[model samples]
Target chain A: MNSRSWFRLKQNAPKLSMLAYMVLFFIFLLGPILIVVAISFTETEYVAFPPKGFSLRWYERFFEYDAFVDSFIVSVELAIATAVLGVGLGVPAALAVTRGHVPFANTIMTFLLSPLSMPLIVMGFALLFYLSALGFGVSFLSLLIAHTVISLPYVVRTVAGVYRGISPDFEESAAVLGANRLQIFWNITLPMIKPGIFAGMLFAMLISIDNLPISFFFGSADTNTLPVVMLSYLEHQFDPSIAAASCIQLIVAVIGLFIVERIYGLDAMTPAS
Target chain B: MILKRSGITTVSAGVVSPWWIAFTGLFLVVFFVLPIVNNLLNTTELATLAKQRPISFYYHKLFTDPYYIRIVFDTVALSVGVTVICIIIGYPVAMFLVRHSGKWSGFIIFLLIAPLLTSIIMRTFGWRVLFARRGLVNDFLIWADILEKPFMFLNSASSAVVGLVHVLVPFMVLSIASVLRSIDLQLEESARILGASRVKTFLKVTFPLSLDGIGTGFIIVFLLANGSFVTLLLLGGGDLKTLPLLIYQQFTISRDFQFAAAMSNVLLAIAVGCLYLQLRLIRRKGVKGS
Candidate 1:
C-alpha cells in the first residue's frame, strides 16, 4: 500500500483492536451472570453447562425448601420496612440540607453520605459492637436499623437532586399567593418531586433486599435474610437451587431498575458531580 | 397561627426546619456515628481489660502479628490491583459509550447497570461457579486444547480479583462515561482541524479532561474493593484471607469482638484516608477544569 493508505490502515488497526478489547471486556463481565441464569434452568441434578434440557425444577425446589421461603419473606419485609424508615428519615434530611438554614450543611451531608464509602463489613462489625454495648442484641430490629442507615444516603442524594431541580420560583410564588408552608409542600413541591422521591425509595428498597454483608452479621438462627441464606447454603451445597434463588434476586433488581428508568430515567440517578 | 407569622415566614415557608435537621441528625448520630465510635472505644476497652495489658498491647498484637499484617496487605494489594485493571478496561468502554450515544449506548448502559444492581452474593456466586473446577471457563480452555485438565482456578487471588473487577468495572465505566459525556465534542473537532492526529488529540485533550473521572472512579472502586468481603469469601478457598474476612471470622467464629473492633477501626482509618485523598483530587479537578 502507498504511504497515505498505510497511515489510514494504521489508524484502523488500533480502532479494530479497541473494538475487540471492549467486546472481550464486556463478555468477561457479563458471561458469568448469563451462565448462572442458564444453569438455573438445567434439568440435571448438577450444574451442567450448555444446560442439559431446560427445566424449572430448581425454581420449584427453591420454593419447596421452607428455610429459603422464610428467608425470602424476611428479606422482602425488611426491605419494605427499610424503604419506609429510609424515606421517613431521608426526605426531611434532604430538605434540611437543601433548603433549611442548617449550620454546616456540607458537613451534615458528608456525614450522611459517609456510609456509602465505609466498608460494609466494618459497618457490620461496628454495629455488632455498638448494639451489644447498648444492651440490644442481634434481632430483626437491629437488622432494620442497619439496612435503614445504609439506604438513607441514596434516598437523601436522589431526593435532594430532584429537589434542587425544581425552581424555587414556584414555591415562592405559592408563598406570595398566601399558601401555608405545609400546604405548599403538600400541593406543589411534593407533586413536582414525586418522581425523584419514588426513584430514591425504589433504589433504597432494592439495595436493602440485595444487601448481604450487614445482613450476614445481624442474621440469627430464625431471622436470616434471603441473600445471607443463599450464602450459607452455598457454603455447604452448590446446587441449581442456589442458582434459581440468585436468579430471583436478579429478576427483582432488573424489574426495579426498569421501573426506576421508566419513572425518572436512570440517567437522572447518575451522580454526575 | 404559626403560618400567619411573617417574622418566622422564611423558615416555615421552606420545606425544612431545625426540627427536621435535628431529627435526622439524632438518628444518624445514634445509629451511624455511635457505632463507629463504639468500635473505637471497644479497641480501648480491650486494651484496658487487665492492669498489665494496656492499649499498646492490642496495637502491638495487631501490628506485630505477621498473619494479620498479611491480611491487611492482601486486602490493599487486591484493591489496588482491581482498581488498576478496572481503569484500563473501563476507560475504553466509557469512551465508546459516550462517543456512540444512541440506541447501542442505552443497551450498553443497561448491561453495565444490571450487574451493579444485582445482589453481591449472587454476583460472587456467579464467579464462584465460573472458577469451579468443572466450570465453563476451564471447560472452554480444555476444549480449545489450552489445557490437558482443568487447573485449580478457584479460591486463588487471581480468581478473586477477576470477580471484583467484574463487579466494579461497571462503576468505573459509569463514572468515566458521565464525565466524558460532559466534554464538548467541539474540542475534539477543533484539535483535528488544527492537524492533530486522533491519538494526539485524545492524549492532549480528551484524556486530560477525563482525569477527574478517572480519579473519582479509581477511589470509588478501590475503597469498595477494600471494604468488600463477599467476593473473597465466596470465591476464596483454603487459607486465603482478606481483612474483611478476618474481621468476620473474629467477630462471628472466635467471638472476639474487641480484636475485631480494633481491626475494623484500622480498616476504617484506611478507608477515610483514601476518601480524604479522593476529596483532594476532586477539588483539584474542579479547580483545574473551571
Candidate 2:
C-alpha cells in the first residue's frame, strides 16, 4: 500500500504543479488581456470587463465617431508607411552590417540600435525641437520619417540576425557558379531572408502603431496617430472611449503579431527586440 | 588556392563602399546626432533662466518642497520596490521555465512574451478595469469578505507599482532565462552528484551563472521604471507624480519649456547613465568571459 501510494504521488506531482502554475500565470497575464477583449464587445457606455449586457455597441459607437475613425485611418496609414520606409532603410543597413566589411561595424550596429537604450520622453523632446527647427512641423512626412527612424533599429537587428543564418558559402558558391551579385541576391539571398524582412516589417508596423510619446511631438491635429489621439483624448476626457481606443490598437497589434508568427516563427524576429 | 582575379569579386559586386558609408552615416547624422544637438541648442536658455531665478530659491523650492521632492522620492522608492518584487517573483518563474519547462518552453515563452504584443495603454486600461473599486478584484475580495469596504487600489501608489512590475517582469524573466539556459546543465548536475542539495546546488552553481542576466535585467527594469509615464499617469490618478509626468506637466500645463528641459535632462541623465554603466560592465565581463 505504501509503495503503491508513493508511485501514484510521483507520477502526479510534476504534472499537477505545471497545471497549477499555468493556471496562475494565465490568470495574472492573459487575465488582463481577456478582460480588455471582453470589454471591447460590451454594450455599456462605460468600460466594463466581464462585460455587462454584452453587445457590439462600443464597436458601433467607435465607427460612428468621425474623429476616432479619422485617427484610425491615420494610424493605419502611418503603420504601413513606416513599415515600408523603415524596412527600406533597415534592410540595406542590416545587409551592410552583416555582409559588408565596414569600418567600426560594431559601433555602427550599436549606434543604429541605440533607440532601444533611450527613454521615450527624451527621444520625444529631442525630436520635437529638431522637427520644429527643420520646419517639418508636424507634417505627415515628418511623422512618417520620425516613426521610421525609431523603427529602423528593429528591422536592422532582425534582418542582421536573419542574414547571419544565410550561409556565407552560399553567396560565394553562387558567385563561383557565375551568378552576378544581383542574381545571387534575387535568387538566393532574398528568398532566404524573406522571413526576416517580414518579421521586421511586422515589428515596425506594431511599434509605429503603438508609439505615443514621439508621435505626441511630431503629430499635429491632422497628423496624430491613434495612440496620440487616445492620449490627447485621455488628457481632456477620461472616459470609456479612451479605453475603447486602447483596445482597438492592442487588437490590431496582436493581429499583426499573429500573422507574423504564422509567416515566420516569432523566435526569428525577436533578435531586433 | 589559385590567385586568379575573377572579374566578379565576391563583395565588390555586392555593396558599393561609398553607398554603405553614405547611407548609414547620413542616416545617423540626421536622426540621432542632429536631434541631440538641436535640443541642446534650444535649451540654451535653461542656464540663463536658472541664474535669473535665485539659486537658493530653486533649491529651497525643490528640496524643502514636499509636493515636488516627495514625489521624486516616492517615484524612486516605488520603482526600486517594484524592481525588487519583480526579481523575487520573476527569477523563480524564469528558473522554472528554463529548468523544468522542456517541450512546453516555446508555448510558455509565447504566454510570457505575448503581453508585449499589445500596447502599454491597452494593458493599463485592463488594469484600471480590473483594479477599480467596483471592478473584478474588489468584487472578488468583497465577496470573500476580506474587507467590509472595498480596497482603494485605483489611482494609488501600490497599484501603479504593481502595473509597472507586471509590465517589466517579462523583460526581467526573458533576460535572465535566456542567459540561464546557456549555463551548462551539467554544472548543476555535477554539484548535485557531489552531494549538494538542490538548494545548495542552485545557490552555488546556477545562481552565479545567471548573475549577469540578473544584473542586466535589474538595470533594465530600474531605468525603464524610472522613465515610465503611462502607468503613472493612468493609474496614479493625480495623487502620485513621476519625473516624466512632471516633465509633461511643465510643458503642457505650465508652458515652462526651460523648466521642462531641465527636468528632461535630469530624467535623461538617469537613463543614459544607467545604460552607459550597464553596457560598459557587460562589455568588460563579456570580454573576460570570451
Candidate 3:
C-alpha cells in the first residue's frame, strides 16, 4: 500500500476497533430479543432459533389462549389506571416539593422517590399481606394500589426534574395579572411541563405493564398480568406462543419509548443522579 | 386585596396548596408506608404467636441457620460479581458513547434503554431461548468443535450472572457516561500536550474523574442484583438459592408469611443501606459540581 494509505489506516485503527466493539455490544443486547421474534414465527411445535420456516402460528396461538388474552387486557387496564393514579398523586407532590416552600424539601423528595430504590419483590410481599389485611384480598384494587406505589416515583422524579428547569417568573407574572392559583397552574405551568407530565405518565404505564415481581404476588385468575401468566406458563411449558407474547410486550415498550423519544428524549429518562 | 374584587384571591406565586401535600401524603401513608410497617408488625406478631420471642426468633434463625447464612453470602457474591462485570463491560461503552459517537449518540442511547423498558420476563425468556438445551449457543459451540456435546448452560449460576449483567449494564453505562460528559475535555488535551500518552491520560485523568460515576453505578447495580430473583428463578434451575427466591418460595409454597417477611426485612436493609450510600454519592457530586 502507499504511504498515505498506510498512515490513514493507522490513524483510523482505534475508531475502527471501538466501532467493532460497539457492534458486538449491540448484538449482545439485541440478539436475544431478535431471536424471540424469529422464534415466534417458526412453523413448529417447539421453540427453534434459526426458525424452520416463517409462519404466524404462534401469533394465532397467542390470540387463542384465553389466559394470555385476559391477562393482557388486565395488564393494559392496570397500566392505564396506574398512569392516571401515579400522575394524579405524583405531579402534585412533585409540585409541592419543588414549589410549595415545604420544609426539608430535599428529605421529602428522597422519601417520595424511595420506592424506586426498594426491592419490588419485598414490596410485593409486604403489600400482599397488608392489602389482604385491609380487605383488598388479592383483587384488582390491590393490584392497582401496589402498581401505583412503585410507579409513582417515576412520575414524581421526571416531573420534578423538568419543573426545576422552568423559570417561576412566568407564574409570577401571570399571578400579578390576576390569574388565580388554579388558573395560573392550568394556563402557564401546565403547558410548559406538559412534556414532563407526558413522559412521566408514559413511564408509569410502561413500568406498571412490564412489572413482574409486584404482579407476581397478586396473581389470581382475574388479576393475573401478562408477565405473571407468561411466567407460570413458562414454568410448565416452552412454546413459540411464549415468544409471540414476548414480542407483543416488546412492541408495546418500543412504541412507548418511541413516543418519549419524540416528545422528551430518552437521555432525560435516566434516574435522577 | 385588589384581586378579591375580581374573585381572584391572590396567592403566593410558587406556593402550591397545602392540600396537595395532604392528599399525596395520605395516599403514600396508606399504601406505601402502611404496607411496609404492617409487614414489620406481622413479622413480630407471627414470631410471638409461634411461641418464640419476636426479634430474637429471627435473629436466632438467621445467625444459626446455615441455609440462611449461605443465602446471604451467595446474594452478596452474586451482586458483587455482577457489578464488577458490568463496570468492566460498560465503562468502555460509556466512553464510546460520550467521547467517540458524536452524531450516533441518540440511537446508541435508545439501544441501551430499549431492553430496560421491555419486561424483565421477556428479557429472561430471550435468555432462555438462547440458553435452551438445543439452543443457538450449544449449536454454535458444537459446530465450532468447542464441545463434543451440548453443555447445560441454563439453570446455572454463570447464566444468572450473564443474564443480570446484560440487564444492568445500561444503568452503569448511563451512570458513568453522565459523569464522563461533565468532565472537561481540555484536561485530556492538556495532558496530551504535556507529552502524556492517551492511555496514561485516561488512567490518570479520565478514570479518576469517573470514579464518582463508578461508585453510583456500583451501588445501583449491586442494589438491583441483590433484590432480583426472576432471573435466578427462571435460569437458576433451583441450583441458585438467594434470599429473594427463598422469599418467593416461602410466600407461594409454604405460605409462611412471617418467615418470608423476616427474610425480606434483611433484603430491605441491604437495599436501604445501598440507597443511603447512593444518595450520599449523588449529594457529594452535586456539592462538588456546583
Candidate 4:
C-alpha cells in the first residue's frame, strides 16, 4: 500500500479501538442483568446461566409464595408513602430555596441534600437507635419515616433544578393581573414545574423501592420490604426464585424510567453533576 | 396578606417568606437531623455505663481495637480501589456518549440507566449468582481450561470491589458526562486547527477541561463506596469486613448501643468530610464556569 493510505489507516485505528471498547463496556453493564433474567427461566432447581431448558416454573413459584406477595405489597406501600411525603415537603422547600429570600439559602439547600452523601448503613443505625429511644420501635411507621428521609432529597433537587430553569416572568405577569400569591403559585408556578415535580416523585418512588440498608434495620417481622426479604433469603438459599423476583423489580424500574423519559426526558431526571 | 399600594415588582418581592423554609427545614430536622444527632448524643452514655465513667471509654475501644482498625483500613482501601477502577472504565464510556450521537447512543444510555435504577440488592445478587461455584464465570473459565479446578469467586475482597465498581460506575459516568457535554467542542476544534493532532488536542484541551467533572465523579464514587454495605455484605463473601458491616454487627449482633453510637459518629464524620469537600469543589467549579 502507498504511504499515504497507510497513514489514513493509522488514523482510523484509534476510532476502531474506541468503538470496540464501547461495545465491551455495554456488555459489562448489561451482561449480568441479562444473565439473571435468563436464569429466572431455568427449569433446573438451582440458579444456572445459559439457563437450562427455559421454563416459566420459577416465575410461577415466585408468585406462589404469599410471603413474596406480601413483602412486595409492603414495599410498594412504603414507596408510595415516601413519594407522597417527599413531594409534600420537597416542592415547597424547592420554592423556598429558589424563590424565597431566606437567609442562608445555600446552607439550607445543602442541609436538605446532605442525606444523599450519608452512608445508608450509618443512617439505618442512627434511625434505629433514635426511634428506639423515642419508643417508636421497629415497625412499618419507622420504616416509612426512614425511607422518606432518604428519598426526600430527590424531590427537592429535581424540583429546584426545574424551578431554577423557569424565569419569574409568568409569576410576575400573573401578579400584575391582580392575582394573589397563592393563586399565582398554583396557576403559574406549579404548572411550569410540574414536569420536575413528576420526575422527582418518580425518582423518590424508585429510590424508596430499591432501598436496602434502612429497611433491613428498621423492618419488623411483618414489615420486611422486598429487598430486605430477598437479601435475608439469599443468605440461606441459591435458587431461580430470587431471579424471578429480581426480574419483577427490573421490570418495575424499567417501566418507571420509560415513563419518566416519555414525560420529562431521562436526562432531566438524572442526578445533576 | 395584602401588600401596601405598591408596584408589581414590590408585590412580588413581598410574596416570599422565611416561614416556607421552616416547613421543610422542620421536617428534615425532626426526621433526618434529629435521628443522627440523637445517635451522636447516645455516645455520651458510654461514659456512664453502671456509674459515671469517662467519655473516652468507647472512643478508646474504637481506636484501640485491632478489629475496628482493620475494618476502617479495609473500607478505605476498598473504596479507593473501586474509585480508581470506575474512573478508568467510566471515562471512555463517558467520552463515547459525549462524542457520539444517534440511536446507538440512546440505547447505550438506556443500558447505563437501567442498571442504576434497579435495586442494588438485585444487582449484587446477580453477581452472587455469577460468582457462585459452578456459576457462569467459573464454568466459562473451566471450559476454556483457564483453571484446573473451580475456584471460589464469591465473598473475596476482589468480588466486593467488582460488585462495588459495577454498582457505582454509572454514577461516575453520569457525572463526567454531564460536565463533558458542557465542554465547548470549539476549543478542541481550535486546538486541532492550530496544528495539534487529535490525541494531543484531547490530552491538552478536552481532558484538562473535564477535570472538574472527574473530581466530582471521584468524590461521588468514593463517598458511595465508603458508605456501601449491601455489596460488601453480599459479595465480600465472609472474607471481607468493612466499617459498615462492623457498625451493623455492633448495633444488631452485639447490641452494644453506646459503642455502636460512637462508631456511627466516626463513620459519619468521614462521610460528611468528603461531602463537604465535594460541595466546595462543585461550588468552585460553578464560579469558574460562570
lDDT of 1 by residue, B221-266 (tens): 9988988877787777634687788887876678666667677888
Best-matching candidate per lDDT: 3
Quickly count the clashes in candidate 4: 2
lDDT (CA) for every model shown? 0.82, 0.76, 0.87, 0.83
**Stretches > 4 Å off in candidate 3:** A1-6, B1-15, B43-55
Model 4 per-residue lDDT tens digits across residues A1-273? 999999998999888899999888877787878888888889999777778898999889888987788899999998899898889989989888888877888888888988888988888888876776677888888988899888888899889989899888777777777888889778888898998899898999999898887888876668999998898888788788999999998788888899888877777555544
Which docking band does candidate 3 fall into? Answer: medium
Candidate 2 achieves a global lDDT of 0.76
lDDT (Cα, tens digit) per residue for candidate 3, span A16-108:
998999999999998887888888899999877789988998999999999999999999999999999999999999988998878888888
Ranking by TM-score: 3, 4, 1, 2
- Model 4's alpha-carbon lDDT is 0.83
Superposition error at A16 for model 4 (Å)? 1.7
lDDT of 1 by residue, A107-192 (tens): 78888887888888888878865776677778899998999999998999988889988888888777767777789889998898
Residue range with the least summed lDDT across 10 consecutive positions in model 3 chain B = B4-13
DockQ of 2: 0.48
Angstrom error of the Cα, residue A145, model 2: value is 2.3
- Computed on C-alphas against the true complex, the DockQ of each candidate is 0.55, 0.48, 0.60, 0.61
Per-residue lDDT, model 4, residue B164, is 90
Off by over 4 Å in 1: A1-16, A268-273, B1-15, B43-55, B285-290
**lDDT for each residue of candidate 2 in B166-258, tens digit (9 for 90 to 100):** 788887887788788889988988999999997899899999888877887887788778878888888876667877888777766776665
